[model samples]
Target chain A: MYRQDEVKEASFFDTGEGLVFSYGPQHPGTGHFRLIVRVIGDTVLSAEPDPGFVHRGEEKLCEYKTWITNIPHLERPAILDAAGMLYPYCLAVEKLMGVEPPLRARYIRPIVAELNRIGSHFYYFALYGVFLGLTTPFMWAFGDREFVVDLVQFIGGQRITHSYFVPGGVRNDVPKRVPSGLVKQFRAWYRDATGRSPSSDELTDDFQKYVLRVMEFLDARLDHYWDLMLNNALFMDRTVNVGKLTAEEAAKLGVVGVTLRATGIKRDVRIDEPYDAYGEFKFDVPVRTEGDSYARAVVAFEEMRQSIRIITQAVEGLPDGPVKNKQHPVNIRVPAGEAIARAEAAHGESVYYVRSDGTDRPYRVRMLTASFRNLIVIPYLSRGAKLAEIPAIYWSQNVWPVEWDR
Target chain B: MSESKIGYIVNELKQALGESIKEVKIDKKMTKITVEKDALVRAASVLKGLGFDHVKGVTGIDLIALKPPEDSFEVMYHAGSYSVQELANIIVTIATRIPRNNPEVPSLTSIWPSCEYHERETYEMFGIIFSGHPNLKRLLLPEWWSDAPPLRKDYRPPGR
Candidate 1:
C-alpha cells in the first residue's frame, strides 16, 4: 500500500526529473493533508500539494451566525491556537461596528495570544522532532506545552477552544492567581529541563537569548541523533539544497511568515503591520536567504525565540482594565458595509473579509488563510528536488491541512 | 493618507472610469463601488494602474430574497498595495448585480491570476458563472454532487 508506483497515481507530482512520489491524506509524516512529489532518482523534482479534505465551509457558516456567536465557532478551525485565530476576526468586527475594547482588555488579549503562541510553537517543535525521528524532544516539548495549556484552561474555562476573545473584549478576565502560577511553572520547567535556572532578568532579555538557550539545548543533544535523526548524514544529503524557492517566487505568491522569511523577504505582518501590542514589543523578524528545507527549520526556531520575547514583554508590562468593551447584546445589528481584518498566526497571515447588510448575521464572510497561501509555494518549490526528500521538505514547511481546508 | 485622501482616491477612480463606473458610495467603514458587467475588467485595469496589485479577497453576496426587479448578486474584489500602508486597510469593492437566472460576469482571472480560485469558489457556491474563466470546475464541492447554490439566500439544506 505504501509502494511508490501506487502512491504516484493517487497523488499529484511534477512530470520531470525522476519519479517524485506522494504520501498524504493518511501518511504519518503529513499531519492532515496529501503531498504530490516529483522525484529525480533519490532527489525531489517538484512537490504539488492537494488539500481541502477537511473543508467545513467555515466562511459560509459564519454568514448564518450572529456576530458574538461566531467567536466560539471560529476557534474550531485551529483549535490549538484559539486566541491568535479569533482575535483578528474580533478586531475586524470591532473596527467595522465602531466598538473599542478597554485598555485592560487589550493587555489581556495579548497575554492570551502570547500564551497561545507559546503552546503552538511548542506543538510545532514537538511535531518537528517527531518527524525528524527524535522522539525524546517530541515528548519533552509536548510535556512543557501542557503546562501552558493548563493556564489557558484556568483562565478561559476550557483548554483548547477558549472562544475567550470577543468583539468588544475577552469572555472573562485573567484570574488574579494565574499569572504568578504560570511564571512559577515556566521557571521550574526551564530549570528542570536545562539543569540551570534561566536568570530572572534573562527571561526578560532580548528574544534572541531566549531562543538561543532553547536551540542550544536542542543542539547539545544533536550528536545523539545526528546521522540517525535531524541532521543525519542521509537527511542533510537529501534536503540541503532541495525544494529551493527564491525570494522572487515567494513574494509573487504573497507567501508570508517563515516561508517568505526563509526566502529572505523579511515580510512579517506583526512587524510590518503591527496590531494589538505588537508595536510596543522589540524583536527581530528572522530571515534566511538559503530558501531550502534547512533554512525553513532555522527560520522556525528563530521565530520561536521572537515569540518568547513578545510574550515576556506582554506579561511584564500588562496593564489593568476590563478585557472587553461594554457593548450591546451579542446579537446587535451591524450597519451595511464590508471590512477586512488580518493577523500574523504561527503559520502566516490569516485574513477575514466580512460583509454585513444592516443585519444580525453577516451578508458574506470570506477567509483567506495562511495555509491556503503557503500551499501554493509547494508546487513551485518542489520542482527539481528528489523523491526521498519529500517528507523532510513537507515537514519543514509546516503545512497544516485543517487550517488550509477550513 | 487621511480620510480625505481616501475620498480623493475614490473620486479620482470615478472620474478616470467615467461612465464605466456605475455607483460609487463610501460607507461608514469601507467604500463601495459598482461597475457594469461589460466594464468590470477595464475598471480593474484602471485600479491596478493606480497601485492595487494584490487582490486580498473576492466575496459574493446573494440577494435573491430581496426580490428586486432584477434579482441581484454583489461580487466584491478587495484590492490593496503594500507601498501605500494607509490604503492597506481601505478596501475598494467593485460589485455588479446580474440577473439571477443568468448570473454570468466576465472573468477577472485574466486581469488578476490570483482571483482564479476565488472566482471559482464563488461560481461553485453562488452559481455565478465567470464567462471566460480558464478552468471552471467546482472547488469546494465534489464534481458529482448536486445541490442548489449553497450561498444563495434561497438555498435551504436537505432537512430544513
Candidate 2:
C-alpha cells in the first residue's frame, strides 16, 4: 500500500542525503520481516528492523488460555521447533505446580527434542541455500529433513507444530517398534522398488534402530553437504570476513545460539544449566572464533552432529518408568509464586517467566525467545555493511520474525 | 553447586546496595533483589561490575487490579553472565516498583546495552516509560496504537 510519494515524505526514512528503501516483507531472506536501510552509494549507513507483520500478542493470549490449552498457541511462534518453544514453558509450569516427571519421560523428552533440533538445523540449511541461490542443496537439505520429521511423527503424531509436550511430562510413551500393518506395507513397497523381498534382519522396524539408521544416513550426508556448500569457493567469498561481529560486540549485544557461539563464547543453556535429561547426556558445545557468516554456518552444522550424538545416547540409555505424572490432573492449578525456566532451543536460549496467583490460568507469562534477543544485531551490524552483504548477514543471524514479534 | 553461586551473588548485592535494597529472596533456582526505585541504576551498575554483563529479559508486572490494588508497576531486569563461569548458571533479578499513575524508571540500557530492545518492548506493552531510554517508541505494536497499553490488566482484549 506504500506509494513512492508517501515514502519520500516520511520523516523516519529521511536520512538527510542518503537514499532509503525497504528490503523486504515478502523476500525469502527477510522471513516476513522488512529492514529499512539508508544507504550512501553502496554502503549501508543505517538499518531499522521493522518486524511485527505476524504479531499475534502471544503473551496476552496466554492469559486467556488455561494450562493445558496454552501449549498449542505458545508453540506457534517457532513452529519449526515447537517442542523447543514448549520445553521451557512446561518446565516453568511444572515448577509452579510442584510436580516432576518420571525418569523415562525425562530421557524421552531430549530424544524427541534433539530430533527436532536436527530437523530445525536441516531446515535452516535449506533456507540458507535459498538465500545464496543454490538449488541443489536446497532440495537435498529439505529431502534429508524428512527422515527426521518422520521420526518425530512416529512419536509426536504430526509432522510439525507437535503439541506433544505437557506440563508434568510428555503426552504418552514412546512406541518401541513400528506397527505391523505399516511394517508389511513398507516391505511390500521395498519389494516393488528393489525387485526383491526384504529380509527380516536387513531392515529392522524398531524405533531406536530406525532413529539410529537416520542418524547414520545424515552423518554421511553432512560430509557431502560440506563438499556441496560449506567448502565451495563461492560461499567462502560471499561469507568470510563479511558482517564480522567480534566477541566483545556480540557479548554486548547479547546474541545467542550459533550467532554467539561463532564469536567464541561458550555460553549454552543446555550446558550451563542442564534442564530435563540434558544432564544425563554427553555432547560438546561447538564454538567458532571467526564471528562471520561462514563461522555461523559451521557452528550450526557442527551442532546438528552433536544433536545426533545426544539422540543416540538418550535412546540407548532410556530408563524404564512411567511416562507422565498421573497424580497431576489436566486442569492443574499453579501456586502463588513465580518461576523462570530457560532452555537451549534449536535457535538459542528461550527464557520463560511465569507468575501464578493460585489459578489455572497464569497471571503473566513472559517469553524472551532467542530470536527476540538476536533482533538487536540487525540494526547494529548493518550500519556499515555492503549492500550485497545484507542478505548474508541477515540469514546468518537466524532471527525468526514471528518469534521475535510475539 | 547452584546454592553457593546464589549465596555469593546475594552477599555481593547486600554489600553493594545495603539499605537501598528493599528485600532479597534466595532460592535454589534463582536470586531476587528488590531495590527502591531511586536505587535501580546503582543496583544494576553494581551487578554489572560483578560480571552480570547482559540481561536475559526485562519484564513488567501490572498490579493495579490486585485485591488491595497495589497501584504500582513492577519492572524486573533478569540479568546473567557469560564471562564468569561460576555466575553462568545463575540469573539474578533486579526489580523496582514505580507508581502506576506516573510510571517512570531509569533505563538500564546505559548499564547493559542488551536491555535496549527489552526495555522498549516493556515500555510499549505496559506504558511504563523508561525516562532515559534512547529509543522508547513502539517496537511491536502498530504505529496507530492509541488505546491503553495492551498488557495492563484493565486493558481488555476485544470480545473479552
Best prediction by lDDT: 2
TM-score of chain B of each: 0.89, 0.95
Docking class of 1: acceptable
Q: What share of the true interface contacts does each candidate keep?
A: 0.19, 0.46
Q: Across residues B23-57, which tens digit of lDDT does each residue of candidate 1 receive? A: 87775446678888887888788777665655656
Considering just the first chain, candidate 2 attains a TM-score of 0.91
Q: Output the lDDT of residue B19, model 1.
A: 84
Alpha carbon deviation, residue A5, candidate 1 (Å)? 27
Model 2 local distance difference test score: 0.84
TM-score of each: 0.82, 0.94
What's the C-alpha lDDT at position A17 in model 2?
87
Candidate 2 CAPRI level = medium
DockQ of candidates 1 onward, in order?
A: 0.31, 0.50
Q: Give the runs in model 1 whose Cα sits over 4 Å from its true position.
A: A1-22, A27-31, A35-49, A132-136, A179-188, A193-238, A328-330, B2-12, B25-28, B66-70, B82-92
